[model samples]
Target: MKFSYDYIKSGNATCVLEMGKERFEFYPTFHSDALGDFVSYLASVHPLCKLSWKEGAFHKINGGITWETGTYLLRWELKRDFEDLEIKITEWQNPMIDRKGDSQLIRKVLEAKCNFNEFVLCVVKELDRVIKQRGILGYRQEWQGYTFPIDGFLDLKYACLYKKPFEITKKNNGTSLEAELNLLMEKMD
Candidate 1:
């Protein structure tokens, strides 16, 4: 089976999962904590699932029927969320219903739809590309200093702030020194 995916932002993050000619779109709520969890899950769990299910059993299991079944569930959930959103919107517009209660209900439904596990998985996968491209995982430092070295590159004002002294090697060129100085100044203020 041919599969592809894309992500779009329209007030909220939306993931579009494409399987062959069919397309399924999911909108996941934007929350820092939830997005962090989704990123971690994609970095760990998703690869294993794709290897085990998509490659191993997916092709052999009843000529891909199992994969189709899972897609069916995803489609059903998407449709149900759409219907719920519509109902909530209508209720919110009604004159008899308490305005506050209707608003709350609408928010609740939107949150539920956005937090659905299947939708979240798709979102994580799509976002992983962006995270990787940004080089987020490449930098690993156990301890980060607040100021630059005190030798030639340091600003006298912030030199005392850095407890550990780092040698000003040739690699610490003018551009890097300027960048570090700017960063330190930003932090100090």
Candidate 2:
């Protein structure tokens, strides 16, 4: 699995998620902190990695992102049970239309089981690349309406690097990974 984020224009970025031959692309408009919203969703869902064994364990992550078209919205859903991670992408048509008197239909565009660990790692690596390619201030300049989510990104990165889910409150300390993370954070700042 691979994840990428590229700034395409003002207030717009193209993001891609792919595994093997299947690739899905979506545009995230930073009109009102969309990047923060999506990252927050990932941070919220990722803690499930440590709780995948709970009985009757079921988890879902849902998010809506506006597309560049201004008329279409992409609905993203991630479902996890045990070691299975099912991700679905659907197109919500005519979001501006009132649903009170009309029927709205959504079309599923992509559905696949994305590996949980791979997905997390791919996101961390890609964001790390973006940070390195574009400095911290550059990211803020490119991604308007929000700053780079370093706290969430570092938590996810530490979880992937140390092979343990570490929340912001319980960060891994006194380790090479911590040193690296701190250095990266400094560079970004």
Candidate 3:
């Protein structure tokens, strides 16, 4: 497995995930509701992992997933109020009928494409099963992203307001999704 990170913003702002065989073409897209739904899913799977939403952040107890590298803590709380939210699940699958709950960020995370592999999609599919069978939030996602440092980087206590994200369409007929992200990266630079 390999790990690489790119800070989409300043500070220690980074998107870090372990990769092996697979390549991450873009960040996972999810709906705003999915964020809360993920919290509900965790409650069903891990009976002992106590989690809740309070004080504008999500909190959880000594909870984590055992990985070969180490015990990665699967806990974090958003610093920003995620209202007026917009999330785009890259795939067209409908979550309400699929049993993955209304907030479907997990599905997007599980379906993302990497350098030469795809595990995100499989993760989403299996997570749905785990949620159904165990009826709890048993899965532990790596703690990624932080708003505090990013806030400091921008010298603001709150994040900038933005509209719901939409799928950036491609201009050419043959351009793949990867190509779109590539173009986006180039333009960002």
Candidate 4:
């Protein structure tokens, strides 16, 4: 099997790997120290390295392993067939940001160990709840005159889950925003 990988540094950092037509994406949130430690271990064993035991196989080559970094949890999973691998680093506690609802949703998803689709569903549900409670105009007003585009959030969700590019324009009009929210909720269903 051929192995190839690339790291994408953008709004959020991600490492992508491709084996044949199959691709896997990893969101590496590790700080320098934790990442350096993992890389050093990998290099120490060279071509034949077994970092740790996981599900009867070496975690570095197959199976999954998790590391706790006080502030976040770093998880790595390698498929048995070697067709895919994923590494996710997420915060242990929700940040004290103004986006309380968003932060709470993220915390719930991480704590529940939900999969990609589950995560998207959770987001959609939370969005629906918020929209229902506060009409689109009210929701926009809560953002302090800032344009909080739901489509952008949807694009990010789709990209992370499907590993493809997606784009959507910002919706400023209340009618348009409500329509878009309804459409997204329908899509999730």
Compared with the true structure, model 3 gives a TM-score of 0.20
Best by lDDT: 2
Query: lDDT tens digits, residues 40-80, model 3?
Result: 33222322222111221223322321111111112221111
Report the lDDT tens digits of candidate 1 across residue range 26-88: 443322222332233322222222222123311221111001111121111122232131111
In model 1, state the lDDT of residue 39: 31
**Once superposed on the true structure, which residue ranges of model 1 sit more than 4 Å away at CA?**
1-11, 32-35, 39-128, 132-189
Q: After superposition, how far is residue 109 of candidate 4 from its true place, in Å?
A: 13
Give per-residue lDDT, candidate 4, residue 9.
25
- lDDT against the true structure, per candidate, is 0.28, 0.64, 0.26, 0.35
Off by over 4 Å in 4: 1-113, 153-189
RMSD of each: 19.7, 6.2, 19.9, 18.0
Using alpha carbons, what is the TM-score of model 4? 0.29
Per-residue alpha-carbon lDDT of model 2 for 72-111, expressed as tens digits? Answer: 6676666655556677778765446444523366778888
Candidates in order, TM-scores: namely 0.25, 0.73, 0.20, 0.29
lDDT value for model 3: 0.26
Query: lDDT order of candidates, best first?
Result: 2, 4, 1, 3
